[model samples]
Target chain A: MEAIYIILAGSLVAVSCGLVGSYLILRKMAMVADAISHAVLPGIVIAFFISGSRDSLPMLLGAGALGIITTFLIEFFHKKGNLQTDASIGVTFTWLFALGVILISTFAGKVDLDQDCVLYGEIAYVPIDLWITDTGTIMGPRVLYISGSVLLVVIAFIFIGYKELFLTTFDPSYAAIIGINTTLWHYLLMGAVSLTTVASFESVGAILVVALLIAPPATAYLLTEDFKKMLIFTCIIGIIVSVLGYYLASYIDGSIAGAMSTVAGLIFLVVFLFSPTQGVVFRNRRSKLSMTLNEEPI
Target chain B: MEDFLYFFSFQDPNIRYVVVGSVLLAISAAIVGCFTFLKKRALIGDAVAHSVLPGVCLAFVVSGTKNPIYLIIGAFITGWLSLRFIDMIVRYSKLKEDTAIGLTLSVFFGLGILILTAIQHSGNANQSGLDQFLFGKAASLVGQDLIVFGSVSIILLLVVGLLFKELTLLAFDEQFGKAIGMPVKGLELVLTTLTVLAVVTGIQAVGVVLMAAMLITPAAAARFWTDKLTTMVFLAALFGAISGVSGAYISFVAPAMPTGPWIVLVISFIAMSSFFIAPRKGILYKQFQQRKYQKQILEENILKAFFHLGEADEQYYGHRKISDLISQRRFVMGRLKGGLQKLVRSGFLKQDREGWVLTEEGKNKGQRIVKLHRLWELYLTEYLRIAPDHVHDEAETIEHIITPEIEARLEKKLNYPSVDPHNETIPYR
Candidate 1:
């Protein structure tokens, strides 16, 4: 029962992150996602300090706002200050993350969060931190409800904005010509990414959230040319990673989030080398075959 | 107050070690950062920083002790491997650079965490201080750590100095360096090694996460102040050293505070300020220059409108109504009114009951603008062979920017043309 709950928690995070990450990688905003994952640290800490509670709503709102601000700062620096996109991302996220770490250290006693927890997360505790009602009814686990609702919200967002998101990701100029609000959709997508990131931060840690956000989508991208198919593959890969990663963690008696990301990386490596359509090994072999055929004048 | 004095006095050996080690680590990272910044691979430093953790854990597990040398070696190996993996992915796959970096960084960090937690559960008592690489332990820098940091800094500095020219060429133009027979590939490898070394040494002070700031923030801030490579490198080093000392002093004053984040915060503050206020390239300066240029373009357009009106009637000094000027060319009403009033104040125009007329000084300026406009149109049609109709919009923008030197050169180039491609007389003072 505990193993089921833990895997459910991990799968919930993996699915949400994988869905949003599909759009992120499609739009070439993977680093921006990474930046937001780290930059939202201060927002969570500040939210905790102000609300004096570990309630999900306040933390999500705070982290969501910071995530938006992180994107805005990166864009502002790139467009206004003439800084390169990479430097803009590096400078903005590190600064905000540093601020967050400092905030946590200063209120070390008041805040229940620690640097280690933020780095690797405590996914094993998912089955332990139960959600109970005022009527003395016991809920299975808080992480499941939190992550499940988030997955639902992400699904709803994708379903409703499918056309707008698709057009904006593939062809922004055409989308603009057709009178779609590209900037609005961009911010909305970023907002969704941030929401997913903050929600998963508890189960997967901030950095590993990036693995779930990037690796599965990237692997899915290699397997197909169709965007919808890519997204579906990403969710499937996400589930596989969670289940396999959980077992790997238990086998090694190590951090579950860490094992999950390691599995994510391993899966990507396999797909990266073996995907029939896009694999490097197959590509080199195909080229060699073509070269020989040309030389032989067949 | 006494604490501040005691901290700075370097009287205590512990404080001395912390301050010197931090400054050295910062200076080396900052110097390497300038090269990465120029190459626009600043985020690569962040990837290398995150990738070092697994290496650190692996070294500890093998050695069964906290040996600085073994840890540094482990960190450098993984850090370098991460860069290689990113390069390989980008070269072989359709994934872009950003995706490759994010994937590599997170996966390596995740592996590191897995090993670190495994080590902790192994009941290794020596693993107590191993986690310090996550948030850094600048305040706990003992003499042994200082020696490691000092030697690494010296090695980094020496390599950077020796290969300064080759690295600069590699950063600015790799293809050009290759064309000139320079060993561009070899230089890139050397620079990559130096970057790994810098991150490995600096992580002990600022930790793995904020180490990116030590590499990138100082270089970014220094970039706002200069265009020369040498000057930028020096300024970045100076800024890095300042932040390092400040971080050490801050932790000294507040024992509860962590050194790494404060160091990052101070450097970020410096960078943010530089972005806003540094001369020439700073945001405020650019905004100011843009506003001034906009005003000049407005005033010049009004002058050109007056010159066009006078040319239509063969009355250069005749008064023209504001409505007539708008009919000639479009202008925002409020901006036009303000521009007209400002022109009057500057003695460029005279107002009377009928409308406004160009003064003697304004007539020459207006005529010069019209001449430059017609001259550019002719130059484009004759030299570049652009269509006559296409030249108007291009000349309209170029006329505002053409300096007197370019105007004279254009006249000489065109052999003093009298009529533009549109058959309008090229006005002259």
Candidate 2:
């Protein structure tokens, strides 16, 4: 039963991250999501300090604010300092993440937060931190509810704004010309990324969260060119990889997050080598320029 | 203060190993980081730093002991492989470099965690301090660890020193290097290996995650201080050593603190300060230059404004009211007043109760300014085929910046034309 709950939580986190990650990959902002996952550390620490507990709402808001700041600082360095995008990202996240680690060790030493927890979160222990009610009623895993609701909100958001998101993501100018609020939608997507990242941080930690966010969407991208089909493929692949990863972890009794990421990577590797159209072997036979013909101009 | 004395004094032989290991690691990381920064592969350091974890775990799993040599070898293998994987993904797939790097880094790190967790569950007694690889425990830099770090640092530094010229050529212009038959690819491989070696050696000191900063930040900070490659490398090494030793010292003083974050924090502080304070490239320097340029442009425009006023009359050098200059040129009242006062102090203008007038000396200076403007305007219209109307705005900006050499060139190029395309007199001194 605990395994089932853990798997369900993993699946939910994967789906939410994968769905949001597809858009991130399309926008060429996958690493920005990576930055948010790490930069939110101080936010979570501050939220934990202020609330004196890991209440989901305050933590969400804190991580969300930091996520926005991360984007702003990346843009700030890229535009103002004239650093390359990758260099700006490298500087901002490492600085923020280092600060976060220092804060946790300094102030939150009393709390359960430790280097182990931050590096590799124990998803297997999620079932232990149950959401119990008064009079001995077992509600569910706290992460399940948090991540499940996030998954629902993400689904609803993507559903309601499908056309707008599709247009803005593929071509923002076209979306704006067609009267869509592209900037608003851009922030909306970033908001969803922040929320999903925070919700998954406890289950998989920062590094694995990045893996889950980039790997599945990247794998699905190799399988198809249709955006809608790509989204569906991502969620399906995310769920499959999460379930497989859980079993692999159980078999080896290792980290679920680690196992899940490894599984996602394995899936990517197979597709990278053997996908029908975009596989490495197939593309190797063709000219290098031919492979890039379908790609959007950088 | 006592703790500082003890740490710096190195009374304990163990402290010597820790401090020495950290300093060597810092020097090596900084030296190799120069090439990485120049190559625009700074983030690859982060990726390889994370990816080396699996190799460490695999080494521990294979060797069943905490041998630093085995771990280094393991790390090198995986680190090297991750770089290949990233390059392959970028070359073969439609995914961009950032995505490939993110994917490769996290996935390799995830594999490392899985192996690490499996090892932990296996209940090895030596598994203690293995978790230190995450955030690093510098206190564990014992005898054997120092040997590994010291030897690797020496080798990497030696290689960098030997290949400096080749590496610089590869970094600055790869195609040029290849065109000159300099074996660019081989040089790049050597640099990448050195980067991996630096990362592997530094991992025990700063851990996997923060190691990238050590690899990149010192070089970034040094870049602000100099444009010369050799000077930048030396400064970067100096900065890296300071941060490293200080980080280890602080971690020793505060038992709860990890060394990696402290090192990162210190280096980031250096980098941030350099960004704001370095002489030529710093933000403050640029801001000062911009302000000086703005003042120069404003003063020049005021001279032009006075010359324009003098143009309206044949004999009068024109004492114009501040309001009239403000109305004519759209100058702000306070700013225009400041420009007039500055010009008066410089003897370019004379201020009276009625208004301001160009001094006799100022008239010649104004004539020179008006001459450059009209010369550029004429050059644009007559030589470059620009319309008479379009040349005004171009010449307005160009008039302030035209060097005497460029002004001379324009006059020669335009054949010493006496009047602009607008048929206005081209004043010449």
TM-score of the first chain alone, every candidate: 0.98, 0.93
Instruction: Tell me the lDDT of model 1 at B176.
Output: 95
DockQ of 2: 0.66
lDDT of 1 by residue, A116-202 (tens): 778888899998999999998998899899999999999999999999999999999999999999999999998899889988988
Candidate 2 structure quality by residue, lDDT tens digits, B335-419: 8889889999999999888788889888887788899988888888777888888988988888888888998888888888888
Deviation in Å, model 2, residue A49 alpha carbon:
1.2
- Which stretches in model 1 have alpha-carbon errors above 4 Å? A173-180, A274-298, B308-334, B350-357, B378-391, B409-426
Please tell me which predicted candidate would have the highest lDDT against the true structure.
1
Identify the runs in model 2 with alpha carbons over 4 angstroms from their true place.
A132-138, A173-183, A282-298, B314-316
Q: For each candidate, what TM-score against the reference?
A: 0.93, 0.95
Interface RMSD of each: 1.1, 1.2
Residue A96's lDDT within candidate 2 is 86
- Judge candidate 1 at residue A166 and give its lDDT: 97
Cα error, residue A69 of model 2, in Å, equals 2.6
